[model samples]
Target: MRIIEDPRSYALVMVILASFLTPFVASSINVALPSLGSELGMGPFMLSWVPTVYLLAVAVLLIPMGRLADIYGRKKIFQFGIILFTVSSVFAGFSISPEMLLFFRVIQGIGGAMIFSNVSAIIFSVFPPVDRGYALGWSATGTYFGLFFGPTLGGFLTQYFGWRSIFYFNVPLGVLCAYATGRIGFEWREAEGEKFDLRGVFLMAISLVFVLVGFSSILSIYGFSLFVVGMFLLYFFYRYECGCDSPLFDFDLFKNRTFTWNGFTTFISYFAGYPVVFLLSLYLQYFHGLDPWMTGIILSIQAFLIALASPVAGKFSDNKSPRIIAAVGLFIIILAMVIFSFSGFLYWIILGLVFMGVGFAFFSIPNSKLVMGAVEKRFLGVASATLVTFRVLGQLIGMALIVLLVDVYLVGGSVAVGPFRALMTVSFILFILLLLVGLVLTLKAR
Candidate 1:
């Protein structure tokens, strides 16, 4: 008979499995977007809101929920988040209109925020420092695999079933994950005398919503005015954070040069990397006329590379400065984006996807180690949440900026490969900026 092992390790596995579900939801939706729009009578401008609302809601709530996880119990909130996410998926599947779907998507984002905010912290807390990289690598594997499978699953469902089937796919997985979490016994020691930063929470939420909404509208109407309002809200949020006794975002983290620079570098990297997946999926279906299942298989190439590379990169970060590792990754991504800009052939696109997957794996795994290492264990939740917030922000901004540029250049209502080239060119520029920032940060880290 097999002996039962450490319960915490079991918990970590469960958490990792649960983590996979959200990305599955996110990436799969991208493939189904066009079909959903046609079936629901959604305008191009309005269709953008599906992903935008989910991202905005997640970004807005990350810090607040992270604080709650720390003060209460991570396991408790994380489990609840899984339930909420499952329920929301069911609701989203049944949505009759674009507006209804957007509402349910926002709800799903909130659930995702709660689950994600505590993940790194919980994993770190459960594993020893020497083995943290290995543990995280396993977790990253789940995440990357989900990313790989998301589009493929979405495509298959959309082609064989209906777009709604993509949402329905979550129900069985969610129930299993919830059961696993419940069975895994983890102890929670609550913090006493910790007060919630209500004011900071409100200001941060308002600021994040304003920023995301403003950016999302940049290609549409009233873009500049919305951006101004977002800027104003951020100004006030900074002021509020500075004054709070227990701020939602600990400004003190900025003093650590490693944390600050790594955080910024991570933001830039994801800004360049994340949006391409969705944009490429759209291009494949709308422009190249690929079937949904084929599109999913095509997108999976990048995800598979990331899954394979991240663990090796994470291990390498332990023995060396992450500067070289991360910079090299960014350089590879820049090269891939450039290749994509010039090549319209499917084989070239596949080659670029492979390079991008490897690059992202190297950049993400090591960068995560750097950020977590910079902060104390006590503040791990906040640090993790802060990094995620920037990542979500980068994705939001990247999507908005690309859509705006594509809209301005394409002129046609339907999306095509030419617009994607323009978008990839912009992605190349962002990767160059990321490379520069990574180099500077690595030097500062030294």
Candidate 2:
């Protein structure tokens, strides 16, 4: 198979593969948390940071790194990301303690930021506008597919081998991806005399970190204080961006209704949507006492549905109004959430998972197409980076809300299935809001 006939296509595939690995590492560790906690004597607070720290790093760094890629060269920064991610993975696999593991995970986030910030930009640049939607759809599918397999694969490896194997699993895949990216070529356009906005970068990074950290700690102590500080820092960060000669985020992008609404809708939808995966896994393992392998099977059902539906949804979005498609998808998600709120039965839970997956597929692929379509080629790096930053922020806020809600509504020290039901209620409400956002944006887009 001469897959390399179009060098750019080959390069896109490598980027997709590299990008896929990060999410795999992100979700794969969830199933292993119990085992990791036991081995490392980690408390629930510290265990939570294992994922929080990584996500926080990625969210904060994404925009700054994307701007840097635009200034320097996308290929240069992307290659560096691969090296950093690979090295960090090795460090994670060999960590002697939780602190050491977290340190490496933070480094892993830096690498992930580099890969994710540049990927959609690279795809847009390589493929012509007409074909870009389908190409991006394929790329988006690769990412969701990674999300699908990550937990299940992590659970399988962790159960049969050890939790450390989750980190180690990326070693070979990373090496191959790095090699593929090296041989792949891109036409680099230098920002002739574009100066970097160091101040804007610093403020944004600090602002996002404070916000995410505060939210992550909401389930713990000083939740109100953290929230206050986070809001204050973000206010300053927005002011800082406004004054910068070269801003990290171009507020002008938000002027486009498609960009604005898609970003907002993506944030809300994913914010409420992703926690279901995390919470459900925990429910099955901790509450129902399912083994790691069995939990993997249950999670796989959701992943499989997503895998099946995403490409179809993406194809439809290319021809029709993504706004309508996305709303329909959210409707499915709402249905799934409603069902989840009422059910404690295992079979019903599985059916709900399937619906949730279908909704995600519908929502994600088209939403991505809409965002990318809204931006010009010149701004693709920043646009893609901004999109990812919002998504990560949404995830951070979503997870924190879930944890906080679980703490408040939980009757005993252990979380009951009832709180999980309440969480579903909240998720459904968020989905309805997303549908409204999508509808307004679609109307405006027309």
Candidate 3:
């Protein structure tokens, strides 16, 4: 095959593949969770760790990996990430124990961090401001496609070949991404020669791990203690970064109002939105008695709509104020969740998914465009890492919250109609509060 030499196409392909792989792996695993857990003999608590561990690894490592990309090279780091992720997927499929699967998942998360931290940075490096939203929109479509297909395809694989096939499915796609990475000619390292703050990375990692682990532990005394320690360490991380000459994360970047507020709102959107697939999968399979394939088909409605809407949202933001676009999107999300809270019929559930699909597309593409468009060239990697970090952190929180709710209402992951409906209702209220804050902040930002 002839090498594609144009820089814009290079960036677009890279972002799409990178964006596709991370979410594909995540949602695919979600659809396979029941089958995978059964084979591994994992209970509800241990099973939750499968996805939690992956997100945690990504959350802790994203900013550090982004800093490394800035210091070393984005293409180099990105290529290595794809290779590592592909290899790990193979190992994860072969794993005979839950422990082994979780370990490989952690490795996969590390690779996920490396792939995503540079995606936006590379796009900005190649695309000019006027065209950046277009690139981001297309990239968002790739992400939504991953979301769109992950469940349906994963269900197909799991049903026929067993859950292990879900992991194996990525082998070819990962190889394709790796091959594409090699062909991209230009390298981005805008922060070369900047000293990497090793201690800061360590401190941040400790703080984040403790806090997340504790929070996921959920209302336990030991968990609360861990949370306290994590909070202190996080505060210490803030103080340390403030004084460092070459901090891994710069405190000053928050001074950019557009960057700051967009980050906050994006975080809120993902927090409330990320768990819908996971929760609904369980609801349909366990409660409604639908098979994985049928559940996947139902779930695809939301992701498919996102794929349809993201590019349009991106293009529209180029013409309108991104703030208004994002706010409208969040408002739609609130509406979707409200429908979910009351959903007993399939129609209501589908309606809710449709609303969420459009909402997330409109919110995410423009929100990302705003944040990336707001930063300076020197801070590209920082901004990219920060945007992703916030999004992942919110996802982590959502998952943790789900675990808590599951323990309280799920009765060993068994379905009780009243409790299940209550869970949805509670989540709906929480989402409204969260998205409302994000909406106010979005409009408030300059």
Candidate 4:
């Protein structure tokens, strides 16, 4: 009598939908920042917080939520996250001030962490490793599909219906995702009897908050002190978790070199990659005189290619060695950064997008597969969350760098060629060095 008979199909479909919606929320805001700034009374520096707060919230919660999913049921937490994300979107849409909007954005980030931390774990629980690559690839493809449309649709909504419409627009789609999640009809609780580490969670949260806030304010002596304190607290958390029988984190997972190296590359890759996407919207619109619609289309190309390539890459990795595929992907990303660093021409930018798109697609699946496969099935939730945590942290730090450079150099929201070029040059140097490090790490990963 059920329309969806197979549990595995339900799992895949639901995860893909969740994956699409969450990233759409994240990526859509980039195109709407100018509109948000204008209407919300925010300056360039303050605009950075629009995305940063959401990411910060997710980064801090992912590991804890992952552990909770293992101890409780992944399904229950996932469903709650989607409803929370959906409700927060509505609240964000109706916000009367920047403060109100940020509070809701934090709520949205918490929901996103809950939803994302469980997705790969769910898939891993439902499918064997041989089949997981294909499902994960398709689900990641869905995420790229969201990334592809996020800017384009966000720009359209902001241009015609106003920026608030971007938030309001998630309502129907979010409701649909939540409904689908319920119908998944299966629960995964691998560590059902394990005790939740409340102290570890508190320590982790404060450590991350200090580290991120201090990273943003790093030009100050106070910020430097906070950063040092954060690092010490992180060490304390590490020491504590290693000794706990029912730790919130799985410290033993990193004993596998493949997992460690793959996680490092994930961190480095996103750290170097996303700032370009974040800043390019401003450049295309303010400096080059493109409208939001045109700018979205320009930005959407890379994700489109990423969507196309991910499934194929996933399948390819299943049949052969992923080492060359991953290395090639990293090299292409470095190459794309080279093109971006030197030129702002439309032709060159398109070329760079082409290379970067394929590169990202090729690199991601292999890295994900390695990290996910290295751990035992019982620790899948933690492994998945750790992979996502690296990604979110990398993205958070990358965006923070943009805010810091923009504040130090540029005067306001509008983009200027001189300042933009200066940021690009610095970003490229850092990007390329990290890419090389990631390459070395990937080659040595198992």
- Give the alpha carbon lDDT tens digit for every residue of 1-446 in model 4: 46377777778778888989888878889889998999989999888898888988888999899888888988888889989999999999998899999999999999999988888888888877678777878888989998888877877898999999989988888888777777776788878888999999999999999998888778799998899999999999999999988898877777889999989999999998888877777778777899866777888888999999988888877776776678888999999999988888888988999998999988998778888888876687788889999998888788878888888667776567898778777878888999999999999888
Model 1: ten consecutive residues of lowest lDDT = 1-10
TM-score of each: 0.88, 0.89, 0.91, 0.90
| Model 3 C-alpha lDDT per residue in residues 1-446, reported as the tens digit of each score | 34367657766787888788789889888878889888889999898889888988888998999889888888899889989999999999999999999999999999998988888888788888778777888888888898778877877888899999888888888888887777777788888999999999999999999998888775989999999999999999999999999999988989989889889988888888988878787778877889866887898888899888888898888888888998898899999988887776777888999999999888888888888888777678778888999998888888788878878887877778888888878877888898999999999988
Q: Write the per-residue lDDT of candidate 2 for residues 283-315, one digit (tens) a residue.
A: 788768898678878877877787677668877
Off by over 4 Å in 3: 1-3, 33-46, 96-99, 278-292, 402-419
RMSD of each: 3.1, 2.8, 2.7, 2.9
Worst 10 residues of 4 by lDDT: 1-10
Show pairs that collide, candidate 4.
Answer: none
* Candidate 3 similarity to native, TM-score: 0.91
Better of 1 and 2 by TM-score: 2
Q: Is candidate 1 or candidate 2 better by lDDT?
A: 1
lDDT of each: 0.79, 0.78, 0.86, 0.86
TM-score of 1: 0.88
What C-alpha lDDT, on a 0 to 100 scale, does residue 344 get in candidate 2?
A: 60
**Pairwise lDDT winner, candidates 1 and 4:** 4
